[model samples]
Target: MAECAFDFEVLALDGTPLPLSQWRGKVLLVVNVASKCGFTPQYAGLEALWRAYGPRGLVVLGFPCDQFGHQEPGDADEIRTFCTLHYDVTFPLAAKVEVNGKGAHPLWIWLKRQKGGVLGIDAIKWNFTKFLIGRDGQVLQRHAPTDRPESLARDIEAALA
Candidate 1:
């Protein structure tokens, strides 16, 4: 059983809107990130995964969010430069968005509906929240902030297979 019915709009770092449907037929790892958060280092692991499996249809789409402690206070340009210089991130990054609370982005609303976290809570507690989507555009898993990107490699491999 998987959550496959949701569709969302993709926005560039500059807020240029795009269609998620264009990424169909590929495996996706969607993550909510914050530049100043302790888990920011996860960006390195995510980039590694993207470089390793990208040719095999895996893409790690990063969505920077400032909803957590204002950790991501930079504008789009700053955020883009930081990701490139500090993490060498090559995967697509969406514009800064609110991933939790009443003003949360619509894409996140659908994500929470598909899989609630510990104790059935629908809120995203912090940065580094990850959702894995299979080639069929189905939600395969919802990983908590504590789940390491390296640990998700097996699942990504399975999805590719």
Candidate 2:
């Protein structure tokens, strides 16, 4: 078994304790999301992936972030409202956080350590970056901001299988 890639807690937009451990035994797609980024529309694709694979053990977790280009300037409430009103998103969204920098969220720090992106760099370059995690809680893959959620169906299916 691979080593656990994450051990941290974050807040839900509603202030609930968002526990990474709750997702054990499920395939998780952890995304750093921004409301105003160019890739914002990816929310629709993510929702589609969730609706299609959720029952089969796929969980898409959105972590609202403003670390890139100030694209997500909203607070937790505003972020939640935008996601629900604009995309009808039913997936999990963590409270607004910094995904890079010295104060980056611990969960993100742990995630980057497990699956550094191209060239083995751990820093996130933009919003909508995706991290695929296996049922064993290990990070399996890292997809760039431009990679559509639908493109990940094959990997998700393989993990679930």
lDDT of each: 0.88, 0.89
Instruction: Estimate, for each residue in 29-128, the C-alpha lDDT of model 2 and write its tens digit.
Output: 9999999999999999999999999999999999888888889999888998899999999999988888899999878888888888888788999999
TM-score to native of every candidate shown: 0.94, 0.95
Question: Which stretches of model 1 miss by more than 4 angstroms?
Answer: 1-6
- Deviation in Å, model 1, residue 142 alpha carbon: 0.6
Roughly what TM-score does model 1 have, to 2 decimal places?
A: 0.94
Q: CA shift at 83, candidate 1, in angstroms?
A: 0.7
Query: What's the CA RMSD for each of the models?
Result: 2.2, 2.0
For residues 1-161, write the lDDT of model 1, one tens digit per residue: 22462267868887888567778889989999989999999999999999999999998999999988999999999999999999998899998888878888888888888888889888999999999988888788999888989999999999999
